[model samples]
Target: MKHLSYLNKYFLKYKWRILPGVLFVIISNIFGVVPAQVIRNAYDLIVENAAIYRLYEGFDRQAIVYDIFSYSLFFFGALILFLYLLRGLFLFFMRQTIILMSRHIEYDMKNEIYAHYQKLSLGFYRRNNTGDLMNRATEDVNRVRMYVGPAIMYAFNTTVLFLLVIYFMFSVNATLAIYALLPLPVLVLAIYYVNTIINQKSEKIQEQLSRLSSFVQERFSGIRVMKSYVREAHAQTIFAEESNAYKTNSMGLVKVQAFFYPTMLLLVGISTILTIYIGGEQVIDGAITPGNIAEFIVYVNQLTFPVTMLGWVTTLIQRAAASQKRINEFLQLQPDINSGSQEIDLNGNISFKNVSFTYADTGIEAIKEVSFEIKQGQFVAIIGKTGSGKSTLANLLMRMYDPSSGDILIEGQALDKIDLHSYRSQIGFVPQEVFLFSDSIKNNIAFGLDAVTDEQVNQAAKDAAVYQNIIGFEQQFETMLGERGITLSGGQKQRVSIARALIKSPQMLIFDDCLSAVDTKTEEEILSNLGKLMKGRTSVLIAHRISTIKNADKILVLDNGRIIEEGTHEELLNSGKAYAEMYQNQLLEEENV
Candidate 1:
């Protein structure tokens, strides 16, 4: 119950549907034994003298028996027909209500997990892989649904019918009832032992499945690498290894189930055989009537199946419990970052005061006492060597991750004091690795806008200098891109990402070398267009090429984790330090060409 406590609200919300469904299940199981009950009456009529003395008063005794048998057969037939009709109707209600309720709850649980996953911090995502999280949201939620739907209903049905059948069997003949249950203790012990094994195996199988999914996800994402390196065979081997591991674990679990189910069935067979032998002897010795023996047989037949289903119900419970434990591991996690209560409009005045950060897992500092400022409507560039924390700095400003030390201020207010949503609404980001949905070019461009018209999309594309290229395609704006913009060239993808951010028209736009993919001519054309767009807005650029940031109003040169130089492009070159050397190297390469 504690493992499933997260779902208490949903259970309570749908109790109206569940209660009536359970009532239907109860009524169905109760009357399910009616056919067996009437079997006893049919036997009694044949085995004993007819009690209707008036009807046979002037008739032969055999004739009277014949008439009694005929009428009894009709009565039993009609009762069975009616009971079966009732059973079918009740089953319909149960399925429609309880099973349907599970589906609704299943839908809610997926939404619940998905919504919570959205709220979870970036750190949470960094800690968990996509495939594992996907497993929890989809497969694990389905396992929980099994516990509520068929397992709960059938478990309840088994218990109630078992009790009623036992009561009837004992009343008919106590000795016969006791003999029929001789294997009960053995079966219980076997179930306990087998379920323990199943529990361990079920969890292992789920883990292996997640790993297989993750392996495939990673390989597909890096398929270009695999193909370019001619390592397709190697990738196949890796996939086979993961798939084999999953299959082996699955087969092991199936083997356990294979042996356990038949053993339980054998026990049920013994129970049936014992009732037939003992009840037949009792009828011969006159300890009980033939009707009682007949009734005992029907009750034993009815009881054996629910008992057999106990093993399956137990398996379902264990699987659900295992899935619940896995799901709870994430559902109970508290995000590292929580939203602030204050709501403030931003004017893009940003200041990083003694800001520093160290990744929690690595314990290595990315930024060390680095401080900078960007006034409204300014165009600033960050230049650095590889692994020099340029992208990390941009990430901190985006609030994807927070600085470990010192504060960032927006318009004189502490960054944490402003509502996160409001602060983010004022900034648009195009990351180094551009991403686009598998959708039309127009939809990708207008991705972040609340309500954007086609004119807005076209304008943003034009501003990105990609409008002509897009229209050159067969579908123009309606042209579809594959996963991660696979159908588009690298330059086109970067421009589309730029268009997506530009469509938002935020006060501050951060471009993390998004123009790196384009040639020098196209980059110049985009930068010229961007200059006009940045007339009254702030822009931050992180780049490697000197030409990209040479016209920036201010440039910060980072070496290792420290800011080594800061100035306008000309002032940096005049300083004859790191920035000057970088400019000279670029000039030498161009001249050499």
Candidate 2:
């Protein structure tokens, strides 16, 4: 019922088209009823009255033959033409209405799912597979459209057509009609039971299918790494296992479908046999005319068709129900990060007050009771070893995840109180792993900005030290980057991402080990450019190398999810603590080299 309610809006939108289509269906069915009546009348004329020729005896024999031929041809021809025209027109409108409704419903579902995804905390994505989300957006939405479009219409038509045929049958011979319909209730119940089983199996099959898609997507994305390690055979074996699982589930569904169709056919056949035996007995006993018996048989066959379609409609509904459940689940998910109702200008003054965070799945604190403040336009550096929570801190600042305890503030207002779009628009993030869409280099660099000019894109690329690289490509800025910038080298991809962030001219900038792929010389040059760019921006640099943070106004060294040391470069070196030890080790390694 809830799923049916979901389709009300779509139905209302197409009611005009649907109304005419349905009226045409009724007219077509009326024409269909005419054939049964014609058969009845033909049987009466031929068998019941041998004196049928007496009426034409007074006319010339040739004239009678011609008149009968002309009348029969014109009457049957017109009836057939009317039926065909009504059926064609109804089908035309029905198809157009269903297609339009399908497209609109699919569009709405995709947009809603995407918008909900945007509102969800990063932790949700971290725990979910990319392929699974893609499947929900595409496959699940398509299933919903199928239900709202064809399934609903077919179900309604089948029900209505079946009831109308049953009413006519009963009107002709009440006892025979009741006997023929006795199996209908049992058949319907059987279909419902079969549908329930199919729905359960289909849900499992869809889950397995999603897993298969995820496995394929992951393996393909990591194909280069697998080939580099000579693990092609191993990857293939894993993929085969997932594919086989999908096949196994699909075959299970097929088995159920196979049994269901045969069972429905048997039920319809039995009902037809029963109707014939009983109606034929009545005709021989003079309880009904031969024409009436003929009409009953025709109506019986018509009833069987709708019954047969009942099985298919049930199957479609079950499949759609499974899909709807998955879509509803996604829509119902609530983001952990609350965007509270308050507005404030983001001036880049950030403060962390006793903040702590844990990954949702593991519940292991990644950052513990960390507190810090960066004044507006300050250049702050966070130095940490692998898994020391530096990236997690940056994530908190971006509102990707909220702290498990305590609070973070931007410009003297709670982070939660700020509008997410406004706050995020004011900040730029360059992640350790650069991501580029399959688009022209110029477009990639100017991704989030509105209608940027080529000159502005080139200047931003130059600032990020990537303009030379772009110009060397065959198409320069017009060159399309392959998926995830696969056609570009690691350093070039990183620089392009940097240019994308820089083009935004953000008030706050976060570079999370974004320079790791670039060579030392290029890294130094880009860093020099960044120094100038950071003059009036609050910038946070997460780095492993001491050189990257030496010029920072303040440096915080993190160890094991806690800040172990904090001070200026000279102050940290003079303290002879963790920061000094790290700096001294790097210096000794350089001297040895």
Candidate 3:
């Protein structure tokens, strides 16, 4: 219930609608309860008039008395029908106001969660899986909507109807009202006991559903790997086990609900029986009339639905409370990184002052007190072996993370001081792991820009050396790719990713081992094209091959997260150090190939 307090702001936002909805509930119940009294009065009219007609059976005016009796009963019946139609109309208005408000709130809640998710740091994604995040925004929000819409509506309707019905019954005769309501206290206790169990079960079910969703999402995304490894049967077995567990949990909830509803109906049934028996005895004792007995019966039947809904509304609220708690867990988390207010052109000399970074999750130092400088228009190359922190440098430059110690500066301004969006907007980064969306090839190339001409996409593809491959397709640039660009070869995917970065026409370019999937000939051609385009723009190249970066103005050779050698290609080759050894080995490998 406390967790559900988060929705108070939304309630306040829609207060005007809610207030009208409450008014409709009250009006509708007033009409609803009055029908029972109308029917009671109509019955008493028939009973009283029939006795008069019997007394006049032998008189000459008996025919006139019968006609009058028939017309009065008809009027009362018509009034009851009219009252019920009015109740139905107000019920419709109630749904329109309150239920629609719930829907609007659900829409707002999902958008807010999605926007917050985008603001969170990469570390947040690493900690929470995608399925759990989706469940909170979608399924959990839906459960809360049940509380917002149906539960709130029925709770109000029930309370109003009960109060009105009880007032009428007690006004007629307190003995019958007392007897009819005696079973309700036990109903309240039953709901209180069942609500706690439902809350616990609902939370467990949501957690298990999230796990199942994650399993399915991962398996679908990696279906190729599973097939290549011939593990389809094994995957199926595991899926079956997970499905069975979900079923088992669902059945546990169903069992409690099974016990809940019948208990409610039994108490309602007891109330009805007591009403009939007690009202009959009072009629015989002359404390009340036969019409009074009929009225009590109508009241009991009128109260039947609202009493049953008490159990259902309790279930909905308990489940909603559990779901809101899960949603609050993420909504309450503040993002680890906060953006700065500074906005400026980011084209300048870049410097890292003794920068060091450690991955918080693995506790492994990826960058250790490394320092470097890149002038405004210099082409700088960083060559390293596997696990030497090449990609980490690219991530840091893109501001995906902040260094654990030291500082990064662009021109004279601190990197963190610059507005994050403004800084990243000027840089084109092609990651080591190429990922393209499931869209047309042209669209993937033009993805970073808000708008682009087809000619620009074509030119960028040519510059990345993927133009020939793309044109060979029947649809050319319009060819649609599968997930992660699976329709293309590994080399083509990397080339398309490079084209996407190039299409941005940014002030700085960072390519982190983007040419690994392509052959040496394609790599040389792409580098030649890049050289022409990178003129007067700061560029950082991280590579495993020496040939790709031999023409750069400055080359850095890293080993074990440290810059062991720094010089131009010629200087490093002559130094006979790690860079020289790497170059010699690559040359021999090329000759053998």
- Per-residue CA lDDT of model 3 for 1-593, tens digit only, reads 89989999999999988999999999999998887777778888888888898999889789999888888888888888899999999999999999999999899899989998999998899889888898899999999999999999999999998999999999999989999999989988988899889999998888888888888888988999999999999999999998899899889999999999988888888988998899899988989887888888888887888988888888889889989999999888988778777887867589989999999998989998899899988999999989998888889888888999999988778888889988888998999989999999999999999999999999999999999999999999999999999999999999999999999988999999999899989999988888888888889999998888999999988778878889899999889988989988998998998
Give one digit per residue, the lDDT tens place, for model 1 in 470-586.
999999999999889999999999999998988888889999988888999989988898898878789999999999999998899998878999999999988999999999998
- C-alpha local distance difference test of each model: 0.87, 0.82, 0.90
In the predicted model 3, the residue pairs found to clash are: none
Residue range with the least summed lDDT across 10 consecutive positions in model 2: 46-55
TM-score of each: 0.96, 0.94, 0.97
Pairs clashing within candidate 1: none
lDDT of 2 by residue, 517-593 (tens): 88878888888888888787789999889987898998989998898888899999999989999999999998998
Rank the candidate models, highest lDDT first: 3, 1, 2
Worst 10 residues of 3 by lDDT: 339-348
What TM-score does prediction 1 earn? 0.96
- Which prediction has more favorable lDDT, 2 or 3? 3
- How high is the lDDT of residue 45 in model 3? 86
Task: Give the residue spans of candidate 1 off by over 4 A.
Answer: 49-61
* Candidate with maximal lDDT: 3
Rank list by TM-score: 3, 1, 2
